[model samples]
Target chain A: SQTIHQWPATLVQPVGSPLSLECTVEGTSNPNLYWYRQAAGRGLQLLFYSVGIGQISSEVPQNLSASRPQDRQFILSSKKLLLSDSGFYLCAWSVSSGLYNEQFFGPGTRLTVL
Target chain B: SQQGEEDPQALSIQEGENATMNCSYKTSINNLQWYRQNSGRGLVHLILIRSNEREKHSGRLRVTLDTSKKSSSLLITASRAADTASYFCATDESGGSYIPTFGRGTSLIVHP
Candidate 1:
């Protein structure tokens, strides 16, 4: 069975501060990783997705960025945070196959930028 | 732009009653899926119905897809309080791309 893990289940950051959220998957290799953000009472916004290491596709151009350092390790970072950056960050992984594989999600990180 | 949209932003029903939510989408899709999210937690995939299929069942969940109308519905039978959660529908476009576009989701509350 494959499992996903995210760190800093909850985070409080000040404006203009740096941000780093990590996600890793076990029991799977070369999986598709994605980063998503959900604002209060809003739908999820896809921030970034990576099909392989060192490859990242950004959906919405914003202050946040994502990187896949290893086959199963993904990181979301920001040089300077904004108030609008506050939201629930989620990490997901799916099988690297054809279209239409169900994605598995992690516990998620609740980030609050004050 | 959101590819899918869920109807009735919120719904409340008594336990044991049936709860049904609808989802509409734009563009052609290879498949549509339903997910459940508990308060302040990650989402769990509930069921997936391919575009070629009309309906599918998994335990208490029954999902129907109308490709002609570009819509889908999720019916939960004999709902329990534990079923209170936000339900979202995602669509995988017909193209080879595997990315799924998500909807705003419908919040369902099962009163005990």
Candidate 2:
């Protein structure tokens, strides 16, 4: 069985501060990793996705960026956060075999930029 | 714009009753997936239906996909209070791209 872990389950950061959120998956190698953000009472928006280490494709342009430092480790970071950057950030993984595979998500991180 | 849109943004029903949610998408797709999310929690994948397939079942849940209409329906039979959650539909666009685009979701509340 595979498990995904994310931390600082909840975070409060002041505007203009640096941000870092980490996601790690165990029991899976070379999995496709993705980063998504959801606003209050809204649907999720894909921010970035990675096919392999050091390879990331961003879906939307904003204050955030993603990196795949290791095969099973993905990090979402920002040099300076903005108030609009506050949202529920999610990490997901899927098999790289097919184009239509189901994604497994982590618990998620709640970010509040005040 | 969102590729997929769920109907009836919110629904409330009594436990033991059947719950049905609909999703409509625009564009060719290789597959459609359904996911459930508890309040303040990450989403859990429920089921996936390929474009070539019409219907699929898992436990008490049934999903039907109509490729011609570009729509899908998810049916939960004998719903329970624990089944209260937001359901989202995602589409895997045709072509080799493996990304799945998600909709806003339909919030379902099952009263016990």
For each candidate in turn, give its C-alpha RMSD to the true structure in angstroms. Answer: 0.7, 0.8
| Segments in model 1 whose C-alpha atoms lie over 4 Å from true places | none
Residue pairs in steric clash, candidate 1? none
Q: Model 2, B1-112: lDDT tens per residue?
A: 5889998799999999999999999999999999999999999999999999999999999999999999999999999999999999999889848688999999999999
- Per-model DockQ against the true two-chain complex: 0.78, 0.82
lDDT by residue (tens digit), candidate 1, B10-50: 99999999999999998999989999999999989999888
- In CAPRI terms, model 2 is classed as high
Tens digits of per-residue lDDT, candidate 1, A2-94, equal 999999999999999999999999999899999999998777888999999999999999999999989999999999999999999999999
Report the Cα interface RMSD of each model, rounded to 1 decimal: 1.0, 1.0
Q: Per model, how much of the real contact set is kept?
A: 0.67, 0.77
RMSD to native, candidate 2:
0.8
Q: Which regions of candidate 2 are displaced past 4 Å?
A: none
Could you tell me the lDDT of residue B103 within candidate 2?
96
DockQ of 2: 0.82
Report the lDDT of model 2 for residue B86.
99
lDDT of 2 at B59: 100
| Candidate 2 positional error at B1, Å | 3.7
